[model samples]
Target: MSIMRRFSFNHATAKFWDQREAVEACARTGSGIGLWREPVQEMGLEASAKLVKDAGVQVTSLCRAGFFTDPTQAAIDDNRKAIDEAAELGAPTLVLVSGGIPEGGTIDSAREGVKEALSVLAPYAGERGVTLSIEPLHPMFASDRCVVTTINEALDLAAPFPAGQVGVVVDTYHIWWDPQVWQGIARAGREGRIASFQFADWVTPLPAGVLTGRGQLGDGCVDFKRYLAEVDATGFTGPIEVELFNDALWARPGAEVFEETRAAFARVLE
Candidate 1:
């Protein structure tokens, strides 16, 4: 099969585009989609589910539902809702970004809070046929975006739970800098913890700020083929979502950006 057969487009790549239009494009190419919560909620869960189902588009994963550094009841409730939404959409994985350091708390304390939150949601997710995917952001995002910033850290957090109940997301943009990433990938594969695999290149920002400058493939320093080889070696054959967040891409028409992204992905895999 073509490597593009497993390609998935993340909605955040075109944050302002219409979800229906995006779904139509994915369906035409047999591509999958990584959906975010706000858009899904805006379109209404049932309507979004119906749209994808009717289009024969696969919902690869949900964008996120984890911000429980404090493990507040509110956070738990919201995540429960997200799990239900994933189930409703036929998304097997619910990506999670453990919230950053809480007020007056150290990174260590913040992580403990994530543990507490997971304890509450893991079983709930498992029962609903959803996997909570722990996505560790880069260390630069530690203070405000996510405290979990490494594959080892994400894997460690998932260890106590059943692999099916909780797993790690191997996102290139986040874990590419880890010296032991290969070993981490192998370990995650051995333990059945790689629930989601995503791609984005690291590039110097063009005044679009760091977070919004996830480079288009081949524009920056990521070696897509190597990442692909390592992941394939791990026996992971899931959708490889191209989740770029470039301000330039987002400014273009959704269909134009969609085609460009697909071509870029095809080039990288070639």
Candidate 2:
């Protein structure tokens, strides 16, 4: 049997493609995918599930499930549904973005919210055999996008959960600039908590919204090979998913972006 290469595409980049088309694109490239809930929901979960099954492509993860820093019971309940969707689609993990500070809230309060949210959802994720991967967005988004802004912060959040239930997503884009990153990666590996490793190049003067400005692999400051080597040393073998949220990439034809992304991913890792 041929060894599968280490690469996965984030469905968000294929914003133009309908659900089935996105799955087919991954299938044609013999690649895996990271799916987002909005598109999956719009396309119907069952329909998306069937398409991935038929196409024989792996759903590496479900893009998100956590955005309730002032987490109410309702937010916890919603994450359960996200877990169910991931299970139905055979996604091994659910990517979680610890939500931003609530109104009249401090960052400390938001951290408490993350703990509360995870406390409610982690057990449920474990029951379903789905790993919850907490992704720490860049500090630039600490106020509005995600509270967990460093791998250390994510690890701290995941530490309480058993390895099977919760782990940290070490996305290079968010953490490449962190001075304490090396220790964080090593500690995550030591604890067996390296859940879903991702890739995105780092560009300067981050774009507004701080969400859509992710650079294509090799187009920015990230040392891709260094990250690969570090993660590889951890003995955690998983797809290094390319998850660029760039508007320019999103505007291009899916096929064109896919081909370019695949090439960039390979080139950077090489």
Candidate maximizing lDDT: 1
What TM-score number comes out for model 1? 0.98
lDDT of candidate 1 over 1-270, digit per residue (tens): 799999999999998999999999999999999999999999999999999999999999998899999988989999999999999999999999999999999999999999999999999999999999999999999999899998988999999899999999999998888998889999999999999999998986544488888988888888889999998998999999989887888889999999988999999889
Could you tell me the lDDT of residue 143 within candidate 1?
Answer: 97
Question: How much lDDT does each candidate structure score?
Answer: 0.93, 0.88
**Poorest lDDT segment (10 consecutive residues) of candidate 2:** 1-10
Q: Which residue pairs show backbone clashes in model 2?
A: none
Residue-level lDDT tens digits of model 2 in 214-266: 88888889998889889989898888788888888877888888888888887
Give residue 225's lDDT in candidate 2 (0 to 100): 82
Model 1 residue 31 lDDT score? 96
- Over the full model, what C-alpha lDDT does candidate 1 score relative to the true structure? 0.93
lDDT of 2 at 217: 85
